[model samples]
Target: MSRKYKFRSQDDLYFISTATINWIDVFTRSLYKDIVVESLRFCQREKDLDIYAWCLMTNHLHMIIGTRGRKMEHTLRDMKQFTAKRILEALAEHPEESRHDWMLWMMERAGRRMPGNDIYQFWQHDNHPIAVFTPTVLLQKLHYIHQNPVVAGFVERPEDWLYSSAKNYYSSDLPLLDVLLIE
Candidate 1:
């Protein structure tokens, strides 16, 4: 995955997608979901990020966000690292998660196999942040993020995806981050 090698710029509205290492479905449990939400909430409160839209699938996440104070890459990096550690900790402390040992083994194997990464490599190193350079691209990413659940047959409409901002985008009542919605 050789990139063309462009430096990351400030205030880049990124539609980022990072998959779980080996595509492990680590987010199939509620505990994992809660930790992710908590991480996002904490970052939003403390990191000065503008979260536009987002979706949490079984093994990956799609987010549209930008930094207001810090660098976008730094903000995203912190969020990913924090979530990985917290999720792993929660999994280790909970004795009720059915795939505890299996999950731990997979994460450990991934950590060893992942080159130049920490011991708990839950997410791929590449953030895959596509800078939203055009209005059309931004809209397309928004639609794609919102439509992911429907495309995966999880729901009939984008608004039906509870983990996504589609509900907030459509209804405006869901407790979501302040979005940079284009008219």
Candidate 2:
């Protein structure tokens, strides 16, 4: 097993990207997307997590966040794990899932490839966290995060993406985190 790197300080904002296992398109369905939103909401409400930015792609997520307590690492871990379970369960129960067996098989193969994870892992374990130490870097990271959906061709405008915080940033009617808006 590889040594896991400890997360940075809880009080400092960090830019993070966590991908899906094998880069599978897990968030293509509303059920899976809801799992991610609920996970983020749970983190903010229960774990004292301050989510500054977020965008949910088909198979991954980018976030800018900080924690008010020392359990930010655990909060991220638990959020991903919990969402994975829920998302997997949704896939299993989905009547219209055309690629169900294929996805499950791929997840199983990935678990086998990983050294110690006994179950089929659904998320990439390594989260790339870039510490947001300056206002300039913070705005840069925010732009990068919010521009993801637009760059992916999922929406014509960033504010049109329902699963992203870009709408909030643009003063649109979307339910998103109360991000620290930067002018």
Candidate 3:
């Protein structure tokens, strides 16, 4: 892992990008997306996470976050672990899922490839955390995060994306996740 992506400062906000193992599009289902949302809510309430911005896509997520009581890395680790287990369970419960078998096999293969993984691996290992040191960089990352859904053709407007904080920035409509406004 490069030091550039490592958690080095507790006070600075970090822009983090984490993806599903193999970019398997696991978040295409509402059930799986809800699991990630609930885990993030738990982390925010219990893990001292201050989310400034966030976007949850079909296979990955991007966020700008600051931590108060716990290290940023530790909080993210717990979130990922919890969500992985929950999402795997969701996959099992939803046999109607068209991609169920293929998705499970892909995750299982990913787990076998990694010595540290148990029977499955849901998320890719690295968060690619980049410390946001300047207003210019922070703004840049925020724009990129919001623009993801639009660029991906999932939404016509950034604020129209329900899974992102773009609405918080661009509209009066409340976003699915509460976020601290950047100033």
Best by TM-score: 3
List the candidate 3 regions with Cα displacement exceeding 4 Å. 1-3, 172-183
Clashing pairs in 1: none
**Alpha carbon lDDT of each predicted model:** 0.81, 0.83, 0.89
Q: How many residue pairs clash in each candidate?
A: 0, 0, 0
- lDDT tens readout by residue for model 1, 7-97: 2776578888878888889888877888888888888889887788899999999998877778777777898898999988888799688
Report the lDDT tens digits of candidate 3 across residue range 1-183: 366569888989999999999998988878888889899999999999988899999999999999987999999999999999999988899888999999999999999999878999999989999999887798899989999999999999999988888878887554422334533
Could you give candidate 2's per-residue lDDT for residues 143-175 as a string of tens digits? Answer: 888889888888888888999887777784432
Model 1 TM-score, 2 decimals = 0.87
TM-score of each: 0.87, 0.89, 0.93
| Higher-ranked by lDDT: 1 or 3 | 3
Worst window of 10 by summed lDDT in candidate 2 = 174-183
Worst 10 residues of 3 by lDDT: 174-183
